[model samples]
Target: MGTATGSSFDTETLRRGVEGTTGNTLLSLYADDAQIRIIDRNTQPSHPKVLRGRGEIAAMLDDVYSRDMTHKLDRCVVQGDHAAYCESCEYGDGTRVLAESMITLRDGKIAEQILIQAWDE
Candidate 1:
């Protein structure tokens, strides 16, 4: 395994990753840790789900991609090893949102991801 630099969380890197994510992009290609946890606090109970590993994460992305969703990265801001991004996306089922997220990286890999939904209808 290649050593990850802490700076991998730079704004540009994160922007590229978020913008570069297409329907064909696999989630495994992004997260490889077994402890990867993604939390969407917008829910009542604070839905916290674990992706397990890269493979499962990849599968999740694949499922989304299979729906032919379109994602647009709007803005990205970074400070130190943390990055925040805003994205406007439209899913195949017509679910659209302008979401913002904060990503933290450790050892050059995504350690935790927190997302909030902000849709402008």
Candidate 2:
């Protein structure tokens, strides 16, 4: 786990946060004024789903945490104040999803994140 340049961003912590996805762990990795943009089949590039602020992000994470799925982080890289990772999830219903995220850090927390996902249909 590497630190992002002068930032205090801990790659290990971020990895755990992403793999866990529980509200507490995940929320701890984000800044209060963080924003998340999601792009996928459900949320196309033309009309992406955006979550502004920690509250909305926490709520969205809570919903995800409640789901019966297994998450695995495949790869992660961090440089300067930026980090990127790929994760795969398999749900109880045998559905699988692959997600890649690019994030920007501020004060050791995620300030902005863009995520793209593809799921089995």
Which of the numbered candidates is closest to the native, going by highest TM-score?
Answer: 2
Clashes of 2: 0
Query: Per-residue alpha-carbon lDDT of model 2 for 64-88, expressed as tens digits?
Result: 8899998888998887788899989
TM-scores for all predictions: 0.65, 0.92
lDDT of candidates 1 onward, in order: 0.57, 0.86
Q: What is the C-alpha local distance difference test score of candidate 1?
A: 0.57
- Model 2: runs farther than 4 Å from truth? none
Cα-based RMSD of candidate 1: 4.6
lDDT of 1 by residue, 23-43 (tens): 333242254663444544445
Which residue pairs of candidate 2 clash? none
Candidate 1: misplaced stretches above 4 Å? 1-6, 10-31, 34-45, 92-94, 118-121
- Show the colliding residue pairs in model 1: 27-58, 28-58
